[model samples]
Target: MSEKKSSLIPKSALTKAWLVWETFPQTCYNYERMMGQAVAQVFSCVIYYLYKNNPEKRKEAMKREIEFFNVHVEFGACIIGMAIALEEQKSEGKNIPGEFITNLKTSLMGPLAGMGDTIWQGVVIPILLAICIDLARSGNGNVWGAIIYTVLILAGAYALSYINFMFGYRAGSEAIMDFLEKGILNKLIKGASVMGCMVMGGLIVNYVSAVCGLEIVSSAQTYSIQTNFLDAVCPKILPLGATMLIYYLMSKKRWSSLKIIALIIVTGIVGGLTGILTY
Candidate 1:
């Protein structure tokens, strides 16, 4: 009774096909963070194209692609690059080299943040929002178009994650030298900064250009004094002034980011409540 138990499942055609999909992640982490995101974006675009072109099973395909981009592909490359550097240190019977690891992390994080913000928030999100908003405003409200955009975004995320995990396994320490020689980090950082500045300008116009009544109260019979210096000067001047003030405070006073953030929040709230400043 105990001997010769029959096997419930047998290996067949399905097992062979599964092996290739398992190996895909390894190829994704070979580059630095910016490069990884670029690759993920390309992959996502291709998937989107496929879904757009195909008629049958398009919905399912789009769903799967979106999941890939959002979950496995987005920041996966950076994680992969970090993992690779760590593993390399481990394999050589050496302590994770402090300087190398520190520089590698420092170098990648800024570029990655920039690239992620520019691509995801700046370009993709705005474009999608524009499309959906336009459609809605026109009274068409093409739900499929919105769905397609969403799928594209999610696909990009998943692809990034998958690529990072696998690349981390293969690249380890070697990627650092390659990354530096290629100057990919510098390019990414520069590009990201430009995008960030543009976004900041847009936000300043949209949110920070408003006026508030902060004039000192006068009991005189004849006239009232208006203390809105921002209104007197050019509308653009106020935001720039505020920005410069914060920058000066940080640079001159050596204030930490957290401290600056807290100070700004407190000042803003107090100023709003006390009518000393306006948004």
Candidate 2:
């Protein structure tokens, strides 16, 4: 292929966007990483746009563009950005630069994973659920409250994604560095962690401590012993104990998550059938 045609076709923004959208869903579980990838794509797109608009600024733009897409560890936007850059470099016959870019991208994956788990899964999801449930309960079981909360949660998620994407794309690498130095991301992560912990405490008291049936079965006499250990020692201990047991099994034993879920379901079914538990 001719050099001009090759450069034009290979490093286009459309191609980078397509790659990001396609890869994002597959790696959606890694929220931070995905965000990084998204940011990366934004960076690439911005660079591509700049190249088209002003060919003279290409080298200078490339030198400083990495910072615009820098995300707090879990932002998958970096991956997308790096991938696009790598592709462009390959097309332009710059193998060593492409490898260096790849290395930089790989280095950030771990930190991003941790941040994503703490922020998105731990804090944001729990807070949203807690608010929705609280509103629904307070509204005399009005379903609309729950619906509204759900919409808010979705809106928050999408808004964050869109803002990050735009910031990365428009400002290039400098925006990311600025966000980090200002400590905005750190504060947000910390806030989310606090909220998540609060929600978890509430959940433990409300959902985790419940026990439905406690009377023991007797065939010959009308004698019954309270089967609930919690009632004997302290009320609402069964759910807490169950929660601890599950936590221990999963964390200490390193059991598979799927297996733990199946065990919980099966145990519940058996307990209900044996009249030891009730809804």
**Poorly placed runs, candidate 1 (over 4 Å):** 1-154, 164-176, 209-233, 243-279
Please count the clashing residue pairs in each candidate, in the order shown: 26, 28
Question: Best-fitting candidate, measured by TM-score?
Answer: 2
Instruction: Write candidate 2's Cα lDDT for 1-279 as tens digits.
Output: 111123343345544564454345343335334344344434455455435655654554444333333333325443443444344444455543544554545544444545667787897777677777777788467797679877886676555554443333344334444655687767877887887788777787776644556465578654223343546776666677787888899899998999898998998888788866766
Tell me how candidate 1 scores on lDDT.
0.49
Error of 2 at 212 (Å): 6.7
What candidate 2 gets wrong by more than 4 Å, as runs, is: 1-24, 27-74, 78-96, 137-141, 169-195, 215-235, 269-279
Per-residue lDDT of candidate 1, residues 66-116 (tens digit) = 221211234435443343335233333546543454455455545555556
True-structure RMSD, every candidate: 15.3, 8.8
TM-score against truth, every candidate: 0.41, 0.57
Error of 2 at 241 (Å): 1.8
Q: How far out, in Å, is residue 48 in model 1? A: 36
